[model samples]
Target: MIQTHRKKAGFQHAGLLLMLLPGVVFVFIFSYIPLYGILLAFKNYNYSMGIWGSPWAGLEHFRTFLTNPDFFRLMRNTLLLNIYSLLFYFPMPIVLAILLYEVRGRFFKRFVQTVSYVPHFLSTVAIVTLMGVLLSPESGIVNLILKSTGAEPIYFMAKPEWFRTLYIGSTIWQNAGFSAIIYLAALSSIDTEQYDAAYIDGASRLQRIRYISLPGIGPTIIIMLLLRLGDLLELGFEKAFLMQNPLTYDTSDVVSTYVYRVGLMGGEFSYATAVGIFNMVLSLILIGIFNQISRKASSVSLW
Candidate 1:
C-alpha cells in the first residue's frame, strides 16, 4: 500500500513536469540557445568568419567601449533615466492601485481602470506621435495655451532638458494602470476580516490602509521591486529611439540606443556586444545587491 501511494504521487509529480515541458523548451530555444552569441563580445566578429570562426580579440572591444569619449555621457543618461523611473514611475502604479482599491463604486472603478489601460495598448510610434501633436510649438494645445498667456512657445521635443521629463511622464502614463493590476491582485489576497476588524474598531480609512493594506501587500511590493532592479538598465529601445532627435541626444541617448546605432547601423558588432555585455553585468550586480539588502531588511527577495 505504501509503495502504491508513492507511485501515485510520483505519477502526479511527473504529470506536472510534463505540463511544464513546453515552457522549458521554449525558453531553452529562445533564451539559452542564443547565449552562444555572447562570444561576439570577445571576438573581432568578421562577417565572413561568423561568430564561431571569428578570431578572439581578448577584451579589445571592452577596452574600446570603456575608453570611448561618450562612455561617461551614455552611462550618465542611462543611469539617470532609470533612476528617475525608479523614483517616479515605480510609485505611480502603487498609488493608482491604492486609489482604485479605495473606490466604492464598482462601475466607476471599472470605467476608470479601462480608460487608464488604453494608453498601455498604444504602439510606441503612436504614443510618440501623440506627444508630438500635443507639444508642437505652433499647433499644439500646450503651446497655444502658453501663447495665449503671452509666454514663449516651448519646443519640448527639441529640448535636451525636457527629454527625461517627457520620457518618464509618458512611461508612467503608459504603464501605471497596467502595472497596478499586480498590486490590485495582491490587495485582493489580503484577509477581508482585517479590514472589517479595523472598521469595527473605528479606525479611519488612512489608518486601515497604513496598518492593514500596506502590510498585506508589502511582500508583493518587495518582490516586484527586486524584479524591477534586475532590469534597471534595460530601457525600452523603441520609445527612446522614436522620441529622440539630434538636439535631444545629450539627455535621451541611452545604452540601448547607442548599441543599436553602433552595432546594427555602424556595423561594429563586437564593440556593441561588449557594451551590451557590460550593461547586462552591471544590471546583474545591481539586482544581486538589492536582493541581498531586501532579504536582510524586509525578509523578502526574488531569490
Candidate 2:
C-alpha cells in the first residue's frame, strides 16, 4: 500500500512539473536573460562596443546620475507620487473588493465587476487622450460644467500642481477594478463556517465582515502592499509622458520619463542603463525591507 501511495505521489509531482514548464521557460527567457544587460550599467556603452566589449568606468555613470542637476527633483517626484498613491489609491481597491464581496445579488455583483474591469482593458494612450479631451479648457465637458457653475475653467493638464492628482485618480479608476479581482477570489476562499459562527453569536453584518472576511484576506492584502512598495520608483512612463508638456514638467517628470529622455531620446545609453539599474536596486532593497517587516508583524510575506 505504501509503495502504491509513493508511486501516486511521483505521478502527481510529474504532472505539476509539466504544468509549470511553460511559466519557467517564460521567466528564463524574459527575466533571467535580460539580467545580463546589467553589465551595461558599469560600462560606457556604444553601438560598436557592445555591452561586454564596452569600456568599464566603475562608478562614473552612477556618479553622473547622482550629481546631475535634476537628480533630487527626479527622486522627490518619484517618491512623492508613489507616496500619494499609497495614501489615496492603494487602499481603494481593497475597500472596493470588500464592498463587492458583500454584494448579495449575483447578477448585480457580476455586472458591477464587469463595468469596473472594462477601464483596465483600455490602452493607456486611449485613457490619457480621453482625459485630455474631457478636461480641455475650450471644448471639454469639465470646462462646460465649470462655466455652468459661473466659475472660470481651469486647464488641468497644463498645470504642474494638478499632475499628481490627475495621475493618481486615473490610476485608481483604471486599475482598481482589475486589482479587486484577486481580493474577491481571496474572499471566496474563506471558510463559510467561521462566518456562520459569527452570525450565530449575534454579530451584525459589519461585525461578521470585520472579524471574518477582513482577516481571511489580510495576508493577500499585505502581500500586494509589499509588492507595490517594491515598484515605487518604477512608475509607468506612457501616461505621464503623453499627458505632460513643458508646463507640467515640474510635477510630472519622473525617473522613468527621465530615463526615456536621456537614454533613448538623448542617445546616452550607458547613463540611462546606470540610472535604470540604480532605480531597480533601490526597489529590490525596499521590497526586501517591507517583506521582512510584514513577516515579523503579520506572519505574511512574499518569501
Candidate 3:
C-alpha cells in the first residue's frame, strides 16, 4: 500500500512538472540564454570583432560613466522618479483593491474594474500621443479650457518640472487596477466565516476592512513591494523616451533613456553596457536589503 501511495505521489508530481514545462523553457530561452551579453560591459565591443572577440577594457567603461558630468543628474532623476512612484503610486492599487472588494454590486464592480484596466492595455506610444494631443499648447482641449478660464496655456510635456508628475500620474492610471488584481485574489482567499463572525460581532465595514481585509492581503502587499523595489532602477524606457523632449531632459533623463541614446543612437555599446550593469547591480542590492528588512520585520521575504 505504501509503495502504491508513493507511486501515486510521483505521478502527481510528474504531472505538475509537465504543466510547468512551457514556462521553464520560455525563461530558459528568453532570460537565461541572453545573459552572455553581459560580457560586453567589460569589453571594448567592436562590431567587426563581436562581443567574444572584443578587446577587454577592464573597468574603463565603468570609470567613464561614473566620472561623466551628467552622472549625478541621471541618478537624481531616476531615483526621484522611482521614489515618487513608490510613495504615491504604490498605495493606489491597494486602495483600489480594498474599495473594489467592498462594493456589493457585482455588475457595477465589474464595470469599474474593466474601465480601470482598459488603460493598462493601451500601448505606451498611444498613451503618450493622447497626452500630447490633450496638452498641446496651441489647440489642445486643456489649453482651450485654460484660455476660457483666463489662464495661460502651459506646455506640459516640455516642462522639466512637470515630467515626474505626468509620469507617475499616468503610471497609476494605467496600472493600478490591474495591479489590484493580486490583492483582490488574496482578499478572496480569506475565510468568509471570519467576515461573518466579525459582522455578527457588530463590526463596521471600515473596521472589518482594517482588521480582516488588510491583514489578509498583507503578505501579498509585502511581496509586491519587494518586487517593485527590485525594479527600482529599471524604469520603462518607452514611455519616458516618448514623453520627453530636449527641453525636459533635465528632469526626464534616466539611466534607461541614457543607455538608449548612448548605445543605440551613438553606438557606444561598451559604455552603455557598463551603465546598464551598474543599474542592475544597484537594483539587486536594493531588493536584497529590503528583503532582509521585510523578513526581520514581518517574517515575510522573497527568498
Regions of candidate 3 where Cα sits further than 4 Å from its true position: 1-22
The residue-by-residue lDDT of candidate 1 on 1-303, one tens digit each, is 999999999998998899999999999999999999899999999988888899999899999999999999998998899889999999898889999999999999999999999999999899999999999999999999999999999999999999999999999999899999999999999999999999999999999999999899999899988988888888889999999999999999999999999999999989999999999999999999999999999889888
Clash pairs (backbone) in predicted model 3? none
The CA lDDT of each predicted structure is 0.94, 0.92, 0.94
Query: Cα deviation in Å at residue 88, candidate 1?
Result: 0.9
Instruction: Estimate the TM-score of every prediction.
Output: 0.94, 0.92, 0.93
Clashing residue pair totals per candidate (backbone < 3 A): 0, 0, 0
Q: What shift in Å separates residue 129 of candidate 1 from its native position after superposition?
A: 1.0
Least lDDT summed over 10 consecutive residues: which range in candidate 2?
Answer: 45-54
- Of the pair 2 and 3, which is ahead by lDDT? 3
The count of residue-pair clashes in candidate 3 stands at: 0
Clash-forming residue pairs, model 1:
none
**Per-residue alpha-carbon lDDT of candidate 3 for residues 78-181, written as tens digits (9 for 90 to 100):** 99999999999999999999999999999999999999999999999999999999999999999999999999999998999999999999899999989889
The candidate, 1 or 2, that scores higher on lDDT is 1
Task: Name the 10 consecutive residues with the lowest summed lDDT in model 1.
Answer: 227-236
Clashing pairs in 2: none
